[model samples]
Every structure is written in structure tokens, then in C-alpha cells.
Target chain A: MTEPGRQGTPLIQLRGVERVYGQGDARVVALGGIDLDVWPGEFVALMGPSGSGKSTTMNILGCLDTPTRGSYRLGDLEVTELDGDGRALLRRYTLGFVFQGFHLLPRVTAQENVELPLVYQGVPTHERRLRARESLAQVGLSGREHHVPSELSGGQQQRVAIARAIVSQPKVLLADEPTGNLDSARSHEIMALLTRFNRERHLTIVMVTHEPDIAAYARRVVHFRDGHIERIEESS
Target chain B: MLGNALREAIRSLGRNALRSFLTVLGIVIGVGAVIAMVTLGRGATQAVSDQISSLGSNIVFLRPARGFGPGQSIIPFKVEDAQALAREVPGVVWSTPVSLRTLTVVAGNQSWSTTVVGAGEGYLEARRWEIVRGRGFLPSELRAGVAVCIIGQTVARELFGADDPIGQRMRVDKFSCEIIGLLDAKGQSAMGNDQDDIALIPLRTFQRRISGSTDVDSIQLSLADGVDNERVLQDIRLVLRERRHLSANMEDNFRLVDSKEIERTLTSTTRMLTTLLGAVAGISLLVGGIGIMNIMLVSVTERTREIGIRLAIGARAADVMLQFLVEAVVLSFLGGTIGIILALTFSFVAAQKLAFPFSPDYGIVVIAALFSGAIGIVFGFFPARRAARLDPIEALRHE
Candidate 1:
């Protein structure tokens, strides 16, 4: 945890990003305008009240949703107006997402789940297996690689999900409530796992959470109120 | 990438084992029914045509017009009429003058009532019969009007069980005729008559002793191969008309029956029947394809969240669609393979039991398999598109 923002280039830059749903009367603005920048090798938490657009911000940051009126440059590439395939390519190479619900494929084992992203990226089987095993080990799920999600505890399932997220060696990890479904003890364990990966690999992590304790793991926490960033707090 | 798609599809399909099997079941029965029906139909047609062709494909039957239908009596045809047909008919190569009489033949302690057909040495050639044992009546014997006969298999078995009948003499009413030959067994005629329940004798002897008349009952003509049978029929008609002195535009006093025409008629009728059966079976295949489509749609809806997760993890929409399509194709292809094996076995056994040729046409099988696979692609396309077009955020939000 000694170094923060040490990598040369700013990884994610967003300016005047807005996402509006529907048209005319049905138009409910999900993200009014979001201006944010995340430097390389930084871990940031997005915290907000319900319906304050924390999820919307995560979706945009994860490249799952496109902004209505702004520029989003993800590592020197404009992503705001990019098509679905272009965003997919960016996600494949640069971004990883861990959902709040721990969306591990139900019938498949942890190792197979971890190998999914690499499979989509057309990685060879041997390399995919090696990298999946390595990622699972990094997430403290070494011996549970063959256990399916149904056979695992909530925390273990979430660990498998994290392994899947980072298996492709993505530069940016976007996690939405990684500990949302876990208890206090299990939540803390997951937070420690994420912290070790962030600190050791210098992996830039953008996580969304309402719990202040969960936000405490990040070096900086950005608070959101009504689709806009209210304030940013830093920890020593 | 294809391998990955296939692997993914396999996993998803394996998740719901019963549903996967049930979904493929429709295809299985459809392909199976089509194959079995076509195969069995062809077998039946082949058996029928074989039976009809056994009546002598190139032979024509010349009977007095009054001899054909019930209540029609005849003065009968003359031996000279058959001789004229043999000598002067354009396409005729041989002729057999037939005269039949129903009489009780006695041998040792056994007596049986059977129809005895009187014809020349050319009868075997005209009827395409073979002397499996002994020998047919010689020309000299036919000319001499010798009391000799060639017995049918049924007659031979009835009179001489477990014993040779070649040199045996059977009583033909007041005349005793030696069994000079035995005709091979022909199970049944196209008209369902047991062909082995009669006996054959030289025509000259039959007319002098049995019939007490010189009038031949019917004339059977064997025409040369490659000659137009209809033209030969017309030539015989003209000759018979002249001999019978029938007026122009009047119905002739004779009937010229072409065995090949009967065969063609029966074949067309059976071909039509098989085609109709094939069409009905094809409908089941179409219904099976519809079933696949319905199941695929349901599968896509059920797996919406999985699709969402894959999309979020950077899976292309095309990739997801391909996975589902490949899954459907695999299911249908596998169903087709199973159906083909089952149909072949079913047809083979059924053909044997029904006494017909068991010709399993692999062309139909190959086409059926490909058709089933193509059905998968066509039917799977819509559902795959639905899954691919799902909004990732909305899908993930779905419970």
C-alpha cells in the first residue's frame, strides 16, 4: 500500500458523461453528468445512497453502458461513442467486472468459470488453465478450483467470481459490492484479498459500495449524491 | 472459438438433462419415422413389382373376349390361332396354347382335385418357369400327344411326400400320366393365387382326351425383348380381329392382355402410395423442427442471466448466438444419427417378417440428417438473436 497513482498514464478519464433513459416524459436521467479521472495503480471506492447512480457510474466505468453526452477515454481510447464490439474489445483487454451477486455460472466449476474471460479472448487451453489456476490461487481459492458455485459458500463463490474477473490480467477491475452478500467476517476476508491484489499487482480497482467499512479498503473513496460526485476522501 | 462455443453449449445443455433429451426426442422420432417409412415403402414396392414381373414381363395373354369376366362364355381359341400368333405376330417369338380342365388325380392311396393346364413345350418359356427337377416335355413328346405331365410343387408334395415323383405315374381320370418334370415353387401370383396348386400337361394330349375338342382355351405369347409391347399388342389385336372376323369399330371378339402393362400400372400405383407416405412423414420432420425452435426460445429466456454474465465478461453477441446454434445443431445431428440406426434395424426386421426386399436407402438417410441439422440452424437463429440482443445490465438485474 506504499504507492498510489505511481503508474505513468491516467487509465480512465471521463468528462461531462451523461446517461439518460427513454425519451421525452419517460426520460429519467441515470447519470446526469459524471466527470472523473482514475490514475493507473489506484484503488477507488464509489459510495452513494440508493438511486444516487452509484450502480450507473459502475456500469459506465465497466463499459457496460454508453454515455449520452461526454467523452470517455479509457487508456487513450475514446469509449463513449464506441459500438458494442469496440467496447467488448476494450473490456476484453483492459477491464474486469465483479458483480454484487457473485454471478458465477452455476453448473461449471471455479476453474472453468475463471477461464471464461480468457476463453472469450481465444486463449489456448494450456495457457488458460495455467492462468486460471494462478488467478484462483491469488484469490485464496487454490484447493477449491474444481468446486462449483452451488457447492461453495457465499464467500467462496465470490472468490471464484473475483478469480474469473482478474484471470485475463485486466488493467482495471470494476467491482460492484464485492462483499454485498457476505457476513462481517467473510466480508473482511474478501476485502483483505482485494487489498493484497491491489497493493501487490498495482491493479487499479474501482469498487462500488454503500458500507463505509467496505470503502475503507480503498486508498480513496468517492461519494456520490444524485448521479454526481459529492466529495472525495483519501486515507493515509 | 468453435470449440469453446461447443463446450459452452454442452455445459448449458447438461444443466437440464431431462429437458435436453425431451427436446431432442421430437427430432429423433421424426427422422426415424421418415427413414423407416421410406425404407419399408420401397421394400413393399419392390416385392410387389417382383411378383408382377414374375408373370412374364414380355408375355401377352390372348383370350377370347368372353373368357375374361364372369358370366362371359367362349367358343375358346384354336391351336391354329396360337400357331398364327407365334408365326406371324411381329414381336412374338414363342406361343403356348393352353387348355385347362378341373379333374381329380389319384396317386397310390391319395386323391386330390386340381386344375390341370394343357400347354406345349413353350409354356415354360412363355411363363418364365424353370424345371427345378427332371425335365420339361420334349418336342417329340408334345408332338406325339404323350400322356406325360409336369406337376406343380403343391401337387407333387400332395401326391408324393418325402418321395421323388419324377418317374411316378398319377391317374388323370381315365388316363395315367407320368410326372416328367416338377416346376419350381412360386409362392403367389400378383393376383394372390397360389401358383403351385396346379399341374401342366402337353396341350395335344389334353385336347384329344380331356377336353374332347380341338379349341385351345387361351394363347400365351412371348414377345422379343426391346420391342414396344403396345405395338406388339396392336399387331396381335389386328390378327385376332381378322381371324375372328370382327367388324370395323366393333369391340373385338378377343382380349390381348399385356403383362408388362399390368406391371406398369401396379408399379405406378405403389409409387404414388410411397410418395404420399413420404410426404406425410416429412410433415413430422417439419413439426420436429418447430419443436426445436420452441424449446430453443424457452432455453434462451431461461438463460438470460447467463447471457448477461457472459456479455459483461466481454463475450461478443455473435459468440453467444453461435454457442446456442451449435448446441441445437449438435442435438439434432445426434438425434438423426440415433434415428437412422433405429430405422435401419426396424426396416430390416419388418422387411423379413413381411416378406419383401429390405433396401435401406442411405441417400434418404443422409438427406434426412442434413435436413434435421439445417432445421436446427433455422430454428435456433431466432432464439440466439434474442439472447444476443438482451441488455446486459437489465439481464444481470433479472432475478
Candidate 2:
């Protein structure tokens, strides 16, 4: 167990983690035994083919799924064996998710989408609005708070997703294929914004992508194939 | 949480305005049917009592057990029985022995068929009948069996027309009778019969002249003031039993009908019919509740990603359940409120057309609204649970 308010410790740790779906003869392994540690203020990239188990690892790290076997610790909390509500609380206070589709509620304004986390935390309405506005401004969306997902371009919508991810100031941000749906120009723009946040705000960002240019923006890359990590590379 | 839920519900409803309206229509119709059936039932009951009271409180009807059935002799009731009851009952204010027969009445060149009733002098007091002109038949004329008659408004209009009907002669089949008196007009009965469309004559004279029998069809009885009806009825029943030589175990051969008993029967029948109508209308509410369940399930499905998003943020499963539950309840409550308003408006217009007083019980309206809300809770549970149990990843992945 890690003590609370500790500094200079890893933000996330995984030891011999394994995830299996189904049973008996029909069983499929999504993740083989693996060990990894992610320190604070680091940006890592996970690259793999389809069914290479990278997405499964991301899902587990995001608190959306539990590993069948292994010890997984998120900051000071042991999350591998957390109950439904415990996992929910871990997701609330520790993790934020960015999906490939920029899953912003279509009917709500960008500001309202960012305020959703505060709403579940029972924050006051006025304070929630202020914090959401601040997050949007921080993401370079100062004048776009009222625009819904449909009204915004692909890059703008992805920025809103990033704003939503960091609005609560979580310990880690897990983005699955963040730039997968954008054109090259929009993709580069999104990556630049992510790079700036990592350097300026010192946020720990773990992004999954197969594009070499997208991976080049990350400080470290972990390559996966056939349900196992193949190599680790330090990008220059 | 409440604000977000309310905003989301409003937005979702706004998104599919037609679907929302269609979903609520069943609830509206159900509630409207309940209000309409109950209101009209109460109004009909009130109208009946009003009409019955207008017939006066002193009148009582007596008929034989067979009740003037077809193919039965009209001489079942005896004039002697009426005389015996008049002499024996303690609260007998007055008794009118009456006999009726259908006869063709002829005057001058015109003739029409009408009912002729043979009644004693006390019949005027029993029926509250007033003489509009001329004078009543004398007691001596009744003893002498002189042929005299009192004509009603309709009979006078047919026979005398713009002229004085008193002192005129009219033919009853083969006999000539002088119209000694004219009766005031009485309004139509609730059953649409004209109360003043007949003629009255001396009981003895008619028994000898037209019926050629000494029997009376029935007798009218008027009771004294402040009389205990149950006691009087028991006393009358006892006397009639003795007069008819009825055994202790035998049922009375005559039916002594009272105004109160008739009122009770009519009110109960109206109550039963009202309940039946209300039950039929209540089925619509059940269907409406099912409609709410169906819509709520659809809503939960439509908002799957929203539920996942809220859950992913920190919302407990119970919180998600409560939001959807509240939304369903709010939808049903809105439907109930609108339905009540519409039903009241319909009842107002209907009351005017029916010529009856309009009044709705707010207690019933509130109860109905609460009942609809409960329906929402019961029906909304499954969908709310389904929403709460959604996998955040799969839900976020949903289109």
C-alpha cells in the first residue's frame, strides 16, 4: 500500500497483469503477463495491430475493466480488485478518458460537456460553470463554450474532449486513438495541443495510436504484438 | 444531479417532439375517460333526484304484486281494499281510489284516443291537482252516479279549443259526460310522458259507466306530517296482511311502494352504473401506464451513452436509476395534469348541453394524479435498472 500525499512515486504500476475473456476451450487472452510503471509528468504511446491487447490494457488503466490476474495499483489505491462503486470512485478522482470518437454529448454545449464530471461530484452549479469555462479557456476554446459537438469541427471537438478529460485534474489521462478520426491537418493540430499540455501543465498522458507521426510526438513508445509487449523505444 | 436530469429530459423530449407527444397521449386519454365517466355519472344521478322531487313529496303509489302484467285481468285490485286501508291506517291523511282504462274521447267533430282515470274527491289533494276553472263534482253527484269529468290541459285543447271547457259535454265511447272542472297543466315526466294528458272522473261513476266492474286498479296515499315512515309502513303492511288473509310465512300479495324506496333503488342503480363506467374508463389508465413503461424503456435505451457518461464521471448506480425514475414520473405527472384540464373543459361544455349543473371534485383529481405517478414508478423500475447496469465502455461505444 502506498501512503497518501506521497511524492516521487510512480503514478501507476502494473505487475504480471493478465486479462482473459471467455472460458475453457473457447477462452481468448486479451493481455499476457506484463509489468510496467508510469511516473508522473510523462507522456507514453502504445502502438499495436488490431487484437494486440493494447486497447485492453488502456481499458484496464482507465478503470473501465478489471484484469483477471495481477496486482495493479493506481497512485495510492489498489484498483485491480475494486468493486463497481470503488472502480467508479477511482475513475472519478484518479482517471480521465478520451475516446477516438470525441464522445461529447451531442445535445449539450461544450461547456456543459466539460462540467459533467463536476455534476457527478455534486459541485455547486455556479462553481461548476466557472471551472468548466476555465478548462475550456485553457484548451484554447475561450469563445466556443456554447457550441455543441455538431457545430464544431473535428479538431475543435477533440479539443473539447481533452478539456473534459483534464477538467477534474485527474492523476492520469488515457486516450484511445485520440487522432484516429481526424484528417492530417486536424491530427497534427490535436497532437500539438496534447504536446503543449504535457510540457506546460506536466499532465501524465498515455495515448494509443498506430500512426508513426502521432507516435513521434510521445516521449516514449511501447510496441505490442500478439497479446504481448514486443519492444520499448525512447523517441528523440 | 436534479438540474442535469431535468435539463436532459427536456432536451431529449425536445429532440423527438412527436414521439414524446404520442407517448403521453395514452395517459391523457385514460385520465380523461375517468374524469368524464365519473362526472357524467354524478350529474345523471343528480338530475334523476331533481326530477323525482319535482313530482312532490306527498304522493305514494300502490300496485298489485303482479304489477299490471299483460294478459292479466285489470280487476285484480278491489275498491273495498282501498276503503279498508283508508279506514285502518293511522297516518292516512287522505286516500284516492283510482281506476284507469283507455277510451276514445269525442267532442263536436273531432275525436282522439286518451286515458280516462276514475278517482275520488281526495285524489285532487293526493296529487296536488288544482282546478283552473269551474267547480269540482259534488258528493251528492258522486252518490247519484251522475256522469261528470274533469279534463286535463291536453284534453281541453283537443275538445274545446279556445272556448271554455267547463259545462261542455264530451262523449266517452257510448256515454255523454259533462266537464265540470278543468285541471292546471303539469310538466312532462322524466320519462317523457305528459302528466296532464288525461281526464279524471268520479270513481263510482266510472266503475259503473266504463269498466262495468267494482274494482280499483290502485290507490294513492298521502301521509300525515312528521310521520315515521318505517312505523307507518309496518302498520300498513300489517293491516293489509290481515285484510288479504296472508299467512305469516307468505309474502304480501300487494306491493306498497313508497317514494323513499323508489328513490333509494334509483340512486343505487345509478351508483352501480357509475362504477361500471368508471371501471371501463380505468382500463384506459392501465393502458396508459403500459405506454409510460414502453416510452421509459425507449428513453433509457436512447440515453444509454448518457447513462454511461454520468456513471463514468462518479455517479452511483442508484443515482442513475433515480434520474430515469424521476423523468418517468415527471412525464406521467405532466400527462395527468393536462388530462385533468382537458376533462374539466369537456365536462363544462357537456354540462351546458345536458342542462345539468357542473362540479368536479378536486380530491378525485389529485388522487388520480398521484395514482398516475405511482404507475410511473412501478412501470419505470425495469428501465431505470437497465440504465444503471449499462457497461460504460460499451455505452460510450454505442452510436
Candidate 3:
């Protein structure tokens, strides 16, 4: 479920990024002196054991959180120094996010969930409806547009979350354990969709998963241990 | 954005409708009680004013102050003193010597204990009461102490039911008196006394037949239009002083009370009660606000994951805050609206049953609604702020 589009310059850049959890005796380091770059048209998988800082690195990349110390850039924007609202606006226009839990609003219809980002953009009702319908169709959930999350199966719900993430044509897509909650069959289905989005739309993707099979779908995999990346390998 | 927020807020409430309605109940009761009490309070105040003014547009009551209160002996007034005031006092339109006694009276099949009033000529006019049927007493009938009486509507109803009492004869304590007229109904006074349960007779008839003495006490008088009640009361004081042979410097032995004074006292008393009732009801409104805050906090806690999702999807913190705040305001606003409608219906029906005045008071309705909305904002802030300030990562990870 993707579209053919152009590839541009490096979309995400991080240098010496460090994330600390607390202070003094309670202090814990999540990410330490990390340097990485994700350019347009690249599909990267992040893998790690528990508390290895892969999730923290994904959060900073997604702009859901900022590193304690880092020079972080999303395209031309200096995100590490940006305030909360600035990061929000950057996320609004430049980023799309998918969670393992498939965080489609439970009380809202699938179509409405897809229209959320545009709703924030103050899109007109007719445009929002049309675009949301198109996105739902893109995810092969056309007839299920009006169904609430609880009314759909797990795979169907994850598809709806994908529709929501990509509806706005964001510059980068961020997925944290997008297939973690699904069975093997559904997990491959979701991974195939992400791969299609990557190859066809050149949508830069940074995904975190513990599953080696899930990481295999990406062109490149970065493995982490403790608080730092152990290696970066290309699948060839 | 505002429209979206409002729609989302409404949708949020709709998701838990039973809980939302229960949450709003406190505010509804609070606002309803306040408006109802205020309307009834002012209604009672207005009713009392109307009754007092109906007594006479500009009327005063003169009575022996000595006998009316504690430790005081009876000081009687002759009918001649009423006549003297009518003839000599400035601003006096008419004066009537009044005698009131509670006694038993019987008709063919019914008997009742009621007040029998003895009043001289111009009595009804002086008291600003009306006769619905038959003629008032003639001067000759008043002077001669005829055995003729005027019945009030309640008295006639009790004695004769639907039968016209005019020209009928009823037995007084020891004698028969012919009913010459029926006074119109005056409903209940502010103090809840029935005003239509009396029978009126000539002053001389009461002094001789009922009291067995020529002694007259209370005097009721109406002043000419635009006359100062104080001036007339003072003039009557001088006339009574000279007639009773009191010394120049001594205080007159009579009491002078005006209808306006009664109205002022009634209204002031009612105003105080209205404030107190509103304050008491207002406190419950505060409780209602607290209820909103409690539910809002619960909602924020419950929807932590939703908030995180929204924030991660690029919803501003202010957007999250506004969403919660809008929900609270909508809750209280709905409660306030229901309360206003309830107050209107209740007060209208109650005023009719209680025979009190009714004013819808649109201004107060609006003010009360706004206050309820304000309460929502004030109480909802804490919970909304907590929701907005939540760390997105922690919230998304919350189980």
C-alpha cells in the first residue's frame, strides 16, 4: 500500500546524541554519543535487546522526545533546540508515526482517524473526507472506513493505523514495533506493506523490532547493545 | 479548529453518556435550586408589596400603642376621634374607626369561627377593599347600628357554598344579621394569612352588640394622592393629643403605621433571604464544579494513551488542554441549560399554587448559565493541565 514518488536529500541527521533518564543516584543512560544519518529512500531497521536504547533513538528520530544532549536535524530544522510547539509543528508536517499497539482512537471511525493530521491542519470537511476515504482505500480498508477500532480485527486495525500515518504524505515514516502485536502471518503482511511503501514511494522509514525476520525486510539493519549501536550491516 | 474541538468534545461526552449525564446532575440541581429560590424569593417579596399597597394606595393604621404591646394597658378610642381626624386632619381622605373581634357565626347547616369587623362609613374605601355585590352601608345605617353585614368570599363559601349570601340572614354570637354585600377575594397575604375570611358590619353594631361597649380602638385612613404619610400621621397625633387632653411635651399615646413601611420591611426581609438562598445554592454549584473536576481528572487518566497518540500524531499540548476544557464547559453548560428550563417550569407552577408573583427573570437565567460555564473552566483547569503536561512517552507506555 504505497505510491511512486521522488527521493530527496538526507532527511534525518543526529550527532553525539545522548539521552539520560534521571539524575544522580537514580541516573540511567538510554542513548550515548550516538551518530547516525538516514537519507531519503532508505529503509532501516533498528534491533536491540531490552533497554539497549533502540526505542529511545527511534523516539528522538520521530520527534516524540528530544535527546538530553545532541545536535539533531530533520532536514533544515534544528530539532534539538526547538521548543515543544516547534517540534510539534515539525512532526505535523514532516513525520508520520505508527505504533505496535495500533493507536487508532477507539471511539472514532477509521476514516476519522486517518483524517486527524489534516484535521489539525484545518482542512475543509469535504477535502478531509475525500482524502481520508482515499487513504482508507489505499490501506485496503475501504468498506471498513466507518468502523471503530474495536469493530476491526488486529491486522485490520494495524492497517487503519498505517492509513492514518501515511494519509498526509509526510517526509518520513516512523514505526516502533509495527508488527509486534500480530501473529507471523499478519506480521509479514505489515512488513510487506512497509517495504512496498519504501520501494515505491521512496518513503524514508526508521523501524524498531526485535524480530530478526522483521529486520531482514529492511535494506540495512543497525543492532544495539547496552546504550550504543554495536554494528550497522547492509543485507546486500 | 474551534469547531473541531467542539465536535470532538461532544463526541467524547457521548462516548460515556450515562457517566456524563450523571456527572452533570450535580450542576443541574445546583443551578435549578438557585434560580427557583431567587424567583420565588422575589415573587414573595412582590406579592407582599402588592398586598400592602392593596390595603390602601396611601393608607396608615392608627392604634393605641399602649394596649398593642407588652406591659401596656388598653387605651381605647371613640368613633368621635375618627370623625375628628376625617374633619380636621390635612391630607386625610377618609377615616374609619375599626373594631376586630373573633367570634363564632352560624348559617343553616354550617358554623365557623371568624373575624367580625365593625367599621364606620368609608371603611372599605379607607382599607382599599371592594364590595363585589350589594351596596355598602349608608350613613344612616352606620349611625343607627343596623343588623346588616357584608361577607367576604371565603366566609360566604364556608357558610353558603355557592349560594349568594346577599340578603341572607346569618346568626352572629347572640343575634341575627342580614348580609347586605360580599367583599371580593384578596387571596392570601405575604405571611400566609387568609384575607377573604372576614365579615364586615357597621361600627356601632359591633361596639354595642359584639363588644357590649362603645369603645373603638383601631383606625384605618387613606390619604389624598401624593400626601406624605408622615405629615398625616403627625397631624393625627396633634388632634388626638388635644382631644385626649395630653400635655404638649408628652409622647402621643397612639401608634401610626404606614403601608409603605410594611412594603419596605417585607421587601428588605425577602432580599436578605434571597441572597442567603442563592448563596446556599451557589455552594452546591461549587460542589458541582468539583464534581466536574473529579470526573475530568479521571477522564484524563483514563485517556492517557489517547493523549499520547494525539501528541505523537502532532497534536499540540494546548490542543489537548482545550479538548478537556471544552468537555468540562460543555458538561456544565448543558447542565445549566437544563436547570434554567427546569426553574422556569417549576417556579411558574409554584407561584400559581402559592399565589405569589412570578417573573421569569431572563437576566438571572443568563447570568447563572454563564456562571456555570465559568465554574467548568475554573475547576477543569487543574485536570486539563495535568493532561497537557503529561510526558508522551510515559503516557503511551501506560498500561
In candidate 3, position B285 carries an lDDT of 94
Best by lDDT: 3
Error of 1 at A179 (Å): 0.6
Query: What's the lDDT for residue A213 in model 2?
Result: 92
Per-model CA lDDT versus the true structure: 0.87, 0.82, 0.89
Candidates in order, TM-scores: namely: 0.93, 0.83, 0.94
lDDT string, candidate 3, B268-373, tens digits: 9999999998999998898999999999999999999999988988888999999899889999999888988898899999999987879867789999999989
Winner of 1 and 3 under lDDT = 3
Model 2 C-alpha lDDT per residue in residues B1-399, reported as the tens digit of each score: 777777766676778788877887877888887887777777777776766655556456777674233553323567777777788888878777888888999999978778899987588877667889988878888667788999889999988788998888999878999999998887665455777788888888898988898877888887776788888888878887787666787666677887767777887998899798788878888898889889889888888887777776667788888888887777777778788888889988898898666867678888888977887788788888889899888887776
Interface RMSD per candidate (angstroms):
0.8, 1.7, 0.7
Per-residue alpha-carbon lDDT of candidate 1 for residues B1-399, written as tens digits (9 for 90 to 100): 998888777776787778878888878888888899889988977887889778776778877865334564565788888888788877898888998888999999999888899986589888888999999999998999999999999898899987999999999978999998999998888778888988888999998889888898888888888998778888888888888776786676677778777777877887888788778877877787788889989888888889899899998888888988998887777777788888899999999998889998889989998988998898888888888888999989877
Predicted candidate 3 versus true structure: per-residue lDDT over A13-82, tens digit per residue? 8899999988999999999879888888789899999899999999999888889998998889889888
Off by over 4 Å in 1: A6-9, B66-75, B101-106, B109-113, B171-176, B208-212
Would candidate 3 be rated incorrect, acceptable, medium or high by CAPRI criteria? medium
